[model samples]
Target: MSSHQPPRPVRFGILGCASIARKLARAMLLAPGAAVAAVGSRSEEKARLFAADNGLDVATTRLHGTYEAVLDDPDVDVVYLPLPTSLHVRWATAAAARGKHLLLEKPTALCAADLDAILAACDAAGVQFMDSTMWMHHPRTAKMRELVDDKDAIGDIKVINSVFCFRANEDFLQNDIRVKPDLDALGALGDVGWYCIRAILWAVDYELPKTVIALRDPVKNQSGVLLACGATLYWADGKTATFSCSFLTNLTMDITLVGTNGTLHVTDFVIPYEEKSAEFSVASKSNFAQLHIGWDPLPSKHVVTTDLPQEALMVQELARLVQNIRDAGGKPEGKWPAITRKTQVVLDAVKTSIDKGSEPVEIAN
Candidate 1:
């Protein structure tokens, strides 16, 4: 770990007392060097209730009404924005102007231009900016990357097929900003499809696709629900990847990679929140049965099950954030600018392709 001060565990000021913020607050409690110093909601009464429910010792951080007030608090060094996708840019820009380190939820903006502007503002202010693509920080993802790098068992990868779909309950629509039309197109892609894309790109060394073709069901107006969508991502080197995402079905997160010589299978691209172990398979295209060598990557096979930690991945991410801050003497270099920018650009391109009737769009890096 770097020897820098590490920013004193990043006093977190959460914007909006949403359920997800509660989870993040809980995770912050578990994450070393991090704490939910304060939480703000439109209603002070609600914010106080939330703080009390969480047993927060510092009640002063629990403010009511107006997100700007939370950002203005001197006690808050890092602001975790869990507001709706549409509100991301406005709040992120404001928080950046205040010189607070930012941890915004994914799809930083509805379009690439907005994302670029937000990043530019953050850059101008020299604030550390991070999108909460928490899965990228998961240890299992690194394990999967290791598996791919160790052998390239998937062999000259040709296709990347993935899906993240689940039928959310009817009650989930209440007051949820995710169902708005302008924001809906980014629904599944940002919410769940981004996970598939992240896994695929990371496995392939974050290569940019040459061209992308996408399609969405227009007849069904579920506002933000991406009932079904598909993308054909063409790599520069002739390799291609195809992905599909939906929100009209039961929860299914699966990723399968096929290559000329072998195949790699990720049974649960997104597993149970309590997942402790992941089951993966590899075999040559020519011979499938004989080479089935499956083993637990965790401490022990028995202990290696999908019973995940209540605060595992998010806490882990916060730990890394602290370390990253320390590494840069309180400001890291590079700082995932490409990932954050590219994520929005690609998502926008995918939406364009969908609107253009699945016509292919040239993807820029």
Candidate 2:
């Protein structure tokens, strides 16, 4: 037999016990390189309940009554923060100051400026910083990215349209933290539009668009939180993209990319319909058959499979990076934080365009 040893699992401290945190805790269990070491909330009882409800053993896991306690825990190697958008800057910087690697939830902050402060702190502390955009870690996303980059596969992308929407029940509409002005504020745009904007940017190799224009109409709640909206982005090279996001419609996570020589379509871009596999359709070299009764080329579907869910994959990646920093004296990966900044920058642009009454906003290079 070989004399190799198993890798040490990265210890994770979860803060706030947000609804999303439960799913992330499960994801941590799914990743071989990660483990939940502690959980903290304003109420120690709440944290205890969360741990119990989530099947975390109280004897092995520490439960704290305050967010600071979790950050101060020496056993915690990384902090999984799924807190509200507004609270990101304060807590994220605090975590970094304590030398804890951060796995922040998406919509990293309410605005780009806030995110900058958080990033600056992480930089100073030399700690890992990554946003929880789970789908980005999916194997299917890599396959799609490879296909788009291969000129022979789909040629150059000319246009893209993406949407992430789902209807919310009355209770959620009235009381969910996402709809609260002081909590999420950005609402549907932050909740769903984030995925769309990321997809558009990824299609163009993360190039910032030349301009962004918000759609004419957007639905907002009484507190002025966005509930539905759309925006279009223009690249200097003539490539264009549009995306829609909403909480007023049936569930739909779709993306369509039209290229010079071919096209691609994915119905579930954010969350795949099934856990084991995901699919996308592609068409190339279209020509009419004799008599033009039907198209000569038909789109074909490609399915990509993964043993672990995308969220688990995300945790695994962060764990691997954190391990390197902790054990091998390696620096944190810059790619994740860099891409996260780009996503936030683009998001701020869309919000600005909307606030300016749909006037096109120029994106600074």
Model 1: per-residue Cα lDDT over 276-325, one tens digit each: 55556665544423455542232111112423343446555554664566
State each model's CA lDDT, in order: 0.69, 0.93
Q: Indicate the worst ten consecutive residues by lDDT in candidate 2.
A: 1-10
Q: Which candidate number would show the highest lDDT if scored against the true structure?
A: 2
- The residue ranges of model 2 lying beyond 4 angstroms of the native Cα positions read 1-3
Candidate 1 stretches greater than 4 Å from native: 1-7, 58-60, 173-175, 182-185, 216-219, 222-225, 271-275, 284-330
Tell me how far candidate 2 lies from the true structure as C-alpha RMSD in angstroms.
Answer: 1.5
C-alpha TM-score for every candidate: 0.85, 0.98
Write down the worst ten-residue block by lDDT for model 1.
295-304
Give the best candidate by TM-score. 2
